[model samples]
Target: MKNNRFLSILFICLLLAVGVSAQNTVKTSVPDTIIIPVVPDSDTIGIARVRNELAAAKLNEANMRMEIELLKYQADAADSLKQAKQMQRIDSLRALTPGVPVVVTGDTLFYLYAKRGGYTPQQRAQMDADAIEELGKRFNLNPDSVYIESTDIVTDIMYGNKVIVSFTDQDGLWANCSRDQLAAKERQVIVQKLKELKEEHSAWQLGKRILYFILVLAGQYLLFWLTSWLYRKLKVRIQKLKDTKLKPISIQNYQLLDTQKQVNLLIFLANIGRYVVMLLQLLITVPLLFSIFPQTKDLAYTIFSYIWNPVKSIFWGIVEYIPNLFTIIIIYYAVKYLVKGLRYLATEIDSGHLKITGFYPDWALPTFHIFRFLLYAFMIAMIYPYLPGADSDIFKGISVFVGLIVSLGSSTVIGNIMAGLVITYMRPFKLGDRIKLNDTTGNVIEKTALVTRIKTPKNELVTIPNSFIMSSHTVNYSSSARTYGLIIHTEVSIGYDVPWRKVHQLLIDSALATEGVSADPEPFVLETSLQDWYPVYQINAYIKEADKLTQIHSDLLQNIQDKFAEADVEIMSPHYMAMRDGNESTIPKEDIKPQTTGTGSTKPA
Candidate 1:
């Protein structure tokens, strides 16, 4: 009986050991085949075979967890239903082969697959954005509360313990980045965007912005009123200055600016002050108003840039051009001093204080002017490159345009200028000279670079262009009148019956009697022509004063008429056709006294 009981206990102990070993085998063993109901039969067979082989190989616990995490990341990251379906297919394939290695790659966020679960990168990004928006809405969570948790196998973006998004090694491999690194970066972007939205919608921030806007509006109104008041004050001050202290400026006896001009200038300045005040007010108000709101802060900066940028550039440009400005100043002063010296020399020459061998006194002023113009032009050329913006395309273009206009319009002006220069050098006439040009006889009043002005004896003022003067014939009467007196001549007709000796004596006696006729030179008479019935007698006399020629000629004729009449000569200036009786003669009957007969008889009675 004891032996039988011992045998039974041993058998039961063996059976229990076998059962425990079988349970252990079942727990550790891997299936050689896997069947998938969702996949196609052919694909399923191949996938199952591969999966069975991997299971038989028995991958480590960590690797299996990584694979599961990768599959879940792909499924969650899908953007569309098609993408989800594709991700499901991929996950099924991955589950079939658990130990397969996955790649994740990106600098910031890793992609699990090249196609991102059949969705493009852009689509996936948009989906991620949508998910973040939904998470924010659902949790009503502040972006500040959102955070990321990273581990060796997976990374999770959380909003207060709620997983908003996740990343895995597969995502890291797709993005060419570490999983934790990508998740952290994603967390930062989402948090920043959500924070912006929250701040934008926050009632406190909105109220603060509104308060700033109202203050800015009030400030703008105050600025406007202040500027207006200041502008009025400035106008009053400017008017006062114009009336009292800043009256028309005069130099010596000449008025440089008249009263009207001064008033106009003051008014213009006042207007400018008003406009500037208004502009300043606008410039200040606009930027401030825009800057009061967050939405328009960037716009405020943009508007400010419109005004500030040019001013900044100009300020810096001026700073940078300081050296060039100094160079220009030196050139200007040097040219100015040199021109001043030249002008002094020219003045001396013109005034006859300094004499040059080949240069005429009249040419001094014009030559100086020409030299000054050339020197100024040369200085301008030298200083042009040093001018701010001189090298710029706009400046060059303006220069070209101006040059073209000058060249086209200055042809006649240049011609006149050249003629004036020629006339100066030729010395045809000087100022105050009595000259006859064309048909106009006048005294030269003024000579300029472009024109000559003359005052005629009738007090008529005439301005003739220098070019016209150069082209016309010029007769200068006063040029030699000082050295040799100008001649005055008159002619009279006498009857041929008169004795030539008597006529000559009468003419000489009449010329001698005329006033203003130089007695030293003496007056003379000539029988110029013998007509059919009369002889033309010419009386010539010299007068020292050319201006007195008219008066002298009139006096000479009066003296001749009186002398001929006193001599009782028959002055037959016109031809006489008469039927003469024996007692009648060419002499006036009244002037002819009847001869006193010896018998004292009245012959006519």
Candidate 2:
């Protein structure tokens, strides 16, 4: 672009200089009429007067011709100045904005500024250049036949009935000229450019171009090979350096990356650089090859544009998006710090360092997570407009698509999450609580957003979904065990011979002897039912450790049997009692020996 501007300035200066020199050189050719002596009455003086008048008239005639030629020179110089000024103005406009130059084989004939119909200036310019190039490929293209046809609205520059370009008033306005002049000037340029292209594309010129094409391809291949070879050598050298020179990357004694990773990173960077070299080679080589052939000359520029246009668009897009990018960053940080503060508050609440009215401390962390998610979501909504291409159809479409997929596929997941949230706030059973749900009794070990895990007394693990847990009933033995002890109860039937009071006393004694049973809330026995053969006695004990309820009950039962046996109470089940009136006690009397008395009968003394 700078080179084009310099050439324009040089051209205008040269034209102005020529005009000034021509104006200085201008001189009126007719000299003052020569003065002569008056003729005498004699024939010699009369003839001298007559010859002098004729010579003076002839000089006057010659001067008239010189004046006419000088006037024509002045008119030509004025036209030249006008042309130079107009070109200078057009060049100025071209430099101010983007304009496509009509280039043919490295020479820029002119730039196209105005777009007609659907074609942009760049596309129009390329089409025209391509037409001209294609015209040169013809065997019998006549430059003399190239002419300009001016109409009321447009002027067409044609080459043998083919319209090279249709110039409109807009183009003339851009050039600071009438449509007719623009067309005429451009027609000459096109003809001359086409002639040059024809000569360059001649057989001998084509042979040289082909040679140059081959050389470029060979050079590109060699560069690619050399790049690969050099990269392999660097890869090996990096590996060697890992053992010999490279140490682990660390920050203040903490290893961030090991030596092997550093070597790998070096090799990765080298590989990327190699790829970039290959890409650069292609970018240069492909365009060169295309420009080498006149037929593909436009293609060279088209390919260049293919790469350049996107790069320019991306660069400008980033530049234009800087303010919005800043806005997004600001929003992100604002929300981030807000959430950080919230997390700290939640931590204080969970640790019981802080408290809120009617808010349970256990609900703190999950509530923070919920609020954090909502805050981040709101931040995204606020920043959406500031995101580059966020308003584009593709971005919106993709968002909608992902939303649809989530809605369709994650119904169960969403349900479980909601249930988990409810369970958290409801304070159902927390970790390490002994709970029973749907006949599965176990101690809660883990709780998550999706499921709650428990380990049964038998050490069997059970995973119940939050949704399922929400719908079913739950019994939490450990929830109230510490505040109000859990009542551990069992039933046993004894014969009617044992008085209800005595039976109750024995049961209470056994329960109070149990390890996990609390004696402060003294053990109690309930006579649940009295049947014809036996009475059912229920022994209940208060226990702080609900988790040891099973083991405590087992020990209580064993203690009950031992206490009844020590008293010789003969605690008999209804199934074992045959004769209620006269039967030896089921408990054997210690220190009583059995002796034989006549027949094979044993008796206790």
The best candidate by lDDT is 2
TM-scores, in order shown?
0.63, 0.66
Poorest 10 consecutive residues by lDDT, candidate 1: 98-107
Residue-wise C-alpha lDDT for candidate 2, range 280-319, written one tens digit per residue = 8899889989998867888999999998999999999999
lDDT of 2: 0.84
Pairs with steric clashes in candidate 2: none
**Candidate 2 TM-score versus the reference:** 0.66
Best by TM-score: 2
Query: Per-prediction RMSD in angstroms?
Result: 15.2, 14.6
lDDT of 1 by residue, 181-203 (tens): 88877677777766765655567
